[model samples]
Target: MLTQEPIYPKPFLKWAGGKTKLIQQYISLFPQKIINYYEPFLGGGAVFFYLYNHYFLSSAFLSDINPELINTYLCIKHDVEAVISLLQQHQANHNQEYYYYMRSYNTENSVERAARLIYLNKTCFNGLYRENSKGEFNVPMGKYKNPQICNPEVLRAVAKALQVAQIEVKPFETVLNYAKSSEDFVYFDPPYHPLSETSNFTAYSRDSFNKDDQIRLKNVCVELAQRGVKLIQSNSDCPFIRELYKDFKIYEIQAARAINSNASKRGKISEVLITI
Candidate 1:
């Protein structure tokens, strides 16, 4: 008898602070028996997808503050064929002008909007998802010689992985309502605390995740910890983050920084994985 190869779904979006590189180091830290998996800040969903592909998670609740991102996931989960069809159109018409035109395009259709977001993400400079004060995606066109805009196989795999998961557009604190104590594992991968004053890139939505937001996240983590929810959080290795997660087991790991415009700043940096 012949066995089929495993098809693991990678992140559909190239997200900033994605945990693809850190998964190896984190494998031992993931809960051994996760009844319910929760990833509140579901950027890239690298870890969530990995866990779903490998583990026997009964359920999952994935969420993010970005409505468009969540909508993209929802589109993939519920209407992947339509989303892929729209992306095929995007792939055929892809050009500098079309990129800019689609960037500013608004649509009431969920599948079309999701396809547009995925197209821009693949073709945008550095694959950085940014929005201006007016809540418009302002990133310019990237210089990829051939960016894959409509990947049917990956989209299908992602749709399969997301079928058992509930994707939502909500704040991080909202997970407390759905997650049960002792049985649920919550993974927090929020925007990292900037290493320096000029390195902040937390404009995931139009709203910025400022220092106050970090404090609030720490408070939420504390409450969840008290409630017996298994928790693991990843953030930049900065004094503020260390101070905030001082009570937890902070494991410092080095990860390559690839998103910085300045090549000098795009090197190995210290990041912390806090487990509780």
Candidate 2:
């Protein structure tokens, strides 16, 4: 097996509520000699790319509950150029009518579908990937004159890095169960419990993370820590969040919200960085 090296580049995406800032702040807590890495909630793979770039692990296991997100990763790893070509076409024909038409269409594994996803993600307001009950891509187009549709270099680099790591689409419990030793480091970034009923934005999937899920995740964190797996998690800063990880080291950090469609609603928000 080829030994993994640090210095991999990041994938280009406008991931909503990404942890790029948080991870950079608390990266020192990550295990230096990571034999295996596990990320159960692989949103945009922001932390995954960071670890790959820093040479933290020889093997990585990435899992997500969202099937479409997993499909997008698979497409990038397997057929990035084709996806790029289709994304370019979507960029070329970007309009309100075209956006709705593409949003309503269902074409699995087609390059057009992947392109629409990328195009909408790049051009949509705040790169928010929310869907209605019918699961249509409904976010309005953004105001950028020339958004980057496809980054061939970033795609190739991410594809190569993912080729070396293991990828899965499963429940969080299944992925957490695999980490039973000290050689593994688990970095969890679960869907946060809303700070308030009015501020909730858990629409990544139809099933949102509730208070029960938050408790369940805390239990999983304790289990991982007891088994000696270095763990770190980021979440919304709230009384419930602090109480849940009372036993762990929680760092309160302020980060700007870059994904909200409303300009007034976009601003700095406190977050918790729990390490164990």
Candidate 3:
């Protein structure tokens, strides 16, 4: 039998609120055994990759409402070589002019779109995948001296880790249709409710996550818990979030502010990890 390299797979995309840094804090929190794993807000998927590396999954179901994000994951899972080929070309032809052009470029090809997103993500300002109100990706290019636009090794490793996974573009609530048993483990990393008005950073796509959505998510969590599906959810450590998940066992998570344009704004903050 073949084996993956010693290097564990990592999330290919640089996503806001990515859980990579906080995985250590989350390590002890995961159940000793997880048969089937579900992550609805599959952002950078740091948690999923870590769980996969530990051989904790019988099968994995990852979904996100962002179609481009899902397409990139799918392309990597199904056709990583093609995506890597395009990425190498992008890396070879990379420049400020090329970056701007690709940011505006649109295509129907799934692989091309996947490669495009990965390329832009590696080079974009702060690696943010935000969009304008008109639905166009609008983040300016970053000033990375030499960005690794194409990482074939990482891509291939991610593909291997995703072999036992089902990737989809769907709403978060849809996890109810599949994860209905105690054997299922569901992790929710939703767009966190804002801590303040000036810090409204929940915009992963055209739509911003609001208080109502957070409430709806809690309702879904309640239903899932009632059904005996083991669940863990992450959210901002704010009054509203605490009040929303008041019924569950919420733990305060110490996490660094992962992203901010201002260097001073990047500091340690509190978050919550709710479990049932």
Candidate 4:
């Protein structure tokens, strides 16, 4: 008998600040071999899918602070078709009435909730997952003529990829504390502290990931590096970021925004890729 490796698909939605472009450049920074992988901030999962596709890693720990985002991952893992069916139904009537209803509704199962979330993401303004004070999906209707609503194929593929990973929804510190000291790689993509006040948009929720969060994240990375865990973190190339990883190697890269609404603000921007 012969064994076969897994093949995963690309992320389905258009994610703001997704690291698809430079993820490959930082691959070499990861541990050469590891017992497991840990990603605390798994937005769009660009790095997760990248590793799952190219490497032989079979066990991993995937987590996110946003419950809705984690729910989407779990839904694709356990109930791909059901979520797809619900999303297809959402596609049928994407007017103001149905959109508001779906946004306000709640469910016992994460899969159903995740279906609604994905539907909203596909149809919302610029694919942004902004919410209101009461935690409702509040982004307005998008301008897509005929977007791909239910991608069952990519869903199934991600589901399979997730089978080899343990998914958790928790804080970055908690996730890192649970990981072993060695033979594990942790990739940090925390909500970046904005370069300027005009550009502050951290979407784990409406609550901002302020300078304090960035500082704490740096402390965690320094500890992880000292413990023999390979670390590669990405954030905006700003003074705070440079000072945080002063002893580490930093690389500058240009990233084009794919989901930003303003076309003028969608051009290349400088970013930092830190490895320790």
lDDT of 2 by residue, 25-63 (tens): 767777778788889998888888888877745688888
Per-candidate TM-score against the hidden true structure: 0.96, 0.91, 0.96, 0.91
Which lDDT tens digits does candidate 4 get at residues 23-61?
766766766677778999888898888888877679888
Model 3 lDDT vs. the true structure? 0.91
| Candidate 4: segments with Cα more than 4 A from true spot | 1-7, 95-97, 258-262
Q: Write the per-residue lDDT of candidate 1 for residues 169-223, one digit (tens) a residue.
A: 8999998898769888999998888888998877667878889999999999889
Q: Is candidate 1 or candidate 2 better by TM-score?
A: 1
lDDT values of the candidates?
A: 0.90, 0.79, 0.91, 0.80
- What order do candidates take by lDDT, descending? 3, 1, 4, 2
Predicted structure with the largest lDDT when compared to the true one? 3
What shift in Å separates residue 173 of candidate 3 from its native position after superposition? 0.6
RMSD value for candidate 4: 3.3
**Model 2 stretches astray by more than 4 angstroms:** 1-8, 260-262
Tens digit of lDDT per residue, candidate 3, span 1-276?
Answer: 899647678998888999988999998888888899999999999999999988556599999998999999999999999999999999999999999999999999999999999999999998998998888999999999999998899899999888889999999999999999898899999998999998888986898889999989999999999999999999999999888888899999899986876789899999999998
Report, for all candidates in order, the number of backbone clashes.
0, 0, 0, 0
Sum up the clashes in candidate 1.
Answer: 0
